[model samples]
Target: MRREWQVFRVATTYVGTVVGAGFASGQETLRFFAAYGRFGLAGVAVATALFCLFGITVMELGRRLRARTHREVLDHACGPRLGRVMDVAITFFLSATLTVMVAGGGAIFAQQFGAPYALGTLVTALLTGATILAGMRGIMAANSIVVPLLTTAVVFLVATSLHDLGVGPAFSQLAPHPALAPARSWWMAALLYVSYNLALSISVLGPLGAEVGNRRVLLWGGTLGGLTLGLMAAGMTLTVGAHLPEAAVEIPMLYLSRSHSQVVQWFYALILWAEIYTTAVACAYGFAGRLGQLWRYREAVVATICLALAGSGFGFSQLLAFFYPLFGLVALVVLAGLMRRSWRLGS
Candidate 1:
């Protein structure tokens, strides 16, 4: 029973870490895959396979190394010198992730509640900081409740939106939404999507591996988590592809929900905020922890979140357009290194 519960926690945490505001909001889906028209489905499939494989490899390595933080595992994978570089990169990326989520929170609040963007961002920052101050316990609790709710809401929103939006005609039409990702091909987009997300998520996942010792638990837990994330990403891509009316908006999912009904829109708006908060807490915790043992962990987390909140003043789409590709390219290098290292570790 304990083992099963641990598996469930790991899986939910994985999903929660990956399905941030940008993801649930549909902006990330639109840019990374859905914008490719029908070709995006192929990208989604590729991302799914990569996600499963990568998730297994990361957790397995973490468990074997008995790593408490991403730094130890990364060092083992890349060796001291390059691993140090990767650590710095991961820390920066985590900070960037928090910034992106803050911006996403602001977008959600302004879009849904007629609240000021900065106010929304500040609200999310405070919530995320409080949660991170509690350490991993807070993150696990947040993901356990928020991830399930967010996932259920996403599935419902997508299903109902599709029923209203319809898919067949969407595929039949070749209208390219102005908001599609800039990757030249669907494959490139998929690889980039998986790469950057892995780079960002490895923070929490490293600790996750350290928290459990069962090899079967790591394997199945990681695979199932990846599969869940893939399904959500694929479903959102398909839904938004069919209904690209809100492709221009930062929170496409919210836009889609509003199209169906005011009640659904308001409900998902709350979910969007929760999604944003989960990722924000995860990123902030991960980033702050990597900086080493400070006088207090809470102090570290507060500093990190404040930095992110300050940096998040840019608009959501603007940050998505710039950061996802740049960090993605870097993450691919890291992923390749990880694959190479893990191949030998398994051998």
Candidate 2:
């Protein structure tokens, strides 16, 4: 029973770390997979496979190396020279991704509540900075509840939206949307989607693998987590694809939920924002932690919040579209190294 509980906790941690603002809001799925129409569904399949494979490899390597941080794991996977390069890339990407999350918070407020964008951005930044200054314990506790609620809500929204659209028609919409798709090819989009998410997730997952140091536990947990992500992506793709140009908003999940009722929309918007808040806090904390007091962590937190607020002007969708793909492309090198290292680790 205790072992099973450990597996469950690890699986949930994996899922929670990956599912954030863009993801829970359905924006990530919309652009990365749903935009390509039926082909996007195929892309989700490809991404699912990679998520499972790479997730396991990451954990296994973390366990074998007894890595204290993702940097150690990266150093082992890539040579010292290349690993140093990747470390800098990961650190920079951490801030970039946090900026994206802050933007997402503003999108949620403005799009869902008819609130001012600037107000939303400022509020998000303030709240995030406070969370960082106070420490992560509260946010981490909140996430334990938020991730499950957010997951359930996503499944419900997707099911309802698909039923209203008719499942056959939803899946049959073969016309591509392609407005802000990161890649022209569906397969390439899938690759980028997994790559970027893995980049963000590796920070926590690596440390987790070292803490557990159990191959069986990591393998089962990662596989389950990957499969759960794939399921959510598939559901979001179908729902968003069915809605078409109308669903091409900043907060697609809220848009879909509003069709059910204004209350549902409000409910989802709050949940989505909570998830975004947690993610922003996590990102800011992680980025500061990695800096290791080169500056005071609180000062780093303040600086990050200010920078992220400035970047939120680019808009959530635009930032995710541009930066995510770039990060994914660079992170692909780390992924390739992980695969190569895994071969020797297994031996």
Candidate 3:
């Protein structure tokens, strides 16, 4: 029972961490799955399967190697030369992802509460930096409290929105693009989405799996994490599909929740902030860990926080649009290489 609960906690944490600002805001689904139209449902299914399968692979690999950090697990998974490439790609993605989260948090604060974006970004960066500096225990402790609250709030929002939303129209909006109709390929988008998220998540999940000390725990954790993400993706799609035009203002989740109730709106805001903390902590920890390996410069590590804050303060939407797809492609290449290696090993 204790072990099972631990697995649940780990899974929730993993899900909560990866979902972050974009997933909660509905932008991630818009960019990845929702872009597919009705075929987007097919994309969601493919993404779910990849999340489960690759998520398991990542956790199992971590458990087998008893990795203390992503570097060890990635090194084993990709080999030394390719691992170096993976490491650089992951580090870059993490930094960019953190920037996105910080920027998203700022946008949420500004739009939801009339707070200045600069003030919100600065406050979020400082708070998240403090959490990261406290280390893994701090992260786990914070998530223990925040994850459940966020999950509950999201569930409530979904339930309330579903009561009012028309399913027929939502489905109609999801039709595939006419230009891409000939390709008959929803699989690529799904694969790309999962590959990208998993790449960013590996830094957190790999170390988390190693910590659990049990394959069962890792498997269950990964399963829970994947399912949670898929559910969020579906919910975001449904909500956004129902009211596509209203989502143009950025932070679609906020709009969805506000339409339901003021309480729901406030809850969503709090949850969004929590999601920001999760991503920010994960990214900062990963960055610090990587820098500790490459340069051993503590001052440089602190400076990275300032850099992230400044970059994010400029504009969240622009940063997200620029970084996510590019990183998605890089993640696909890394995953393809991993799959090839796994195939050879199996043979």
Question: What are the per-model numbers of colliding residue pairs?
Answer: 0, 0, 3
TM-score of 1: 0.92
**Better TM-score candidate (1, 3):** 1
The TM-score of candidate 3 is 0.89
Candidate 3 weakest lDDT stretch, 10 residues: 175-184
Model 3 CA lDDT for position 266: 80
**Candidate 1 on 14-108: residue-level lDDT in tens?**
88888886788787788778778878888888999888888878888877887767888778777899889988888888888889889888887
- If both were scored by TM-score, which would come out higher, candidate 2 or candidate 3? 3
What is the Cα root-mean-square deviation between model 2 and the actual structure? 2.7
lDDT of 3: 0.74
| Structural similarity to truth (TM-score) of each candidate | 0.92, 0.88, 0.89
- Sorted on TM-score, best first, the list reads 1, 3, 2
> Each prediction's Cα lDDT score?
0.81, 0.80, 0.74
Error of 1 at 156 (Å): 1.1
Error of 1 at 9 (Å): 1.5
Candidate with top lDDT is 1
Flag clash pairs in model 1.
Answer: none
Instruction: Report the Cα lDDT for residue 15, model 1.
Output: 89
Over 1-347, each residue of candidate 2 has an lDDT whose tens digit, in order, gives 47776677667667777888888878888889988989999999999988888888887877877865578888988889999999899888888888888888887778778998788888887887887676534444555677778888999998888778788987777469767577789999998888888877777678678877788999998898899889999999988888888888877887788778777878888888887877777677667657644787767777788878887888887877678778889988888888787677657
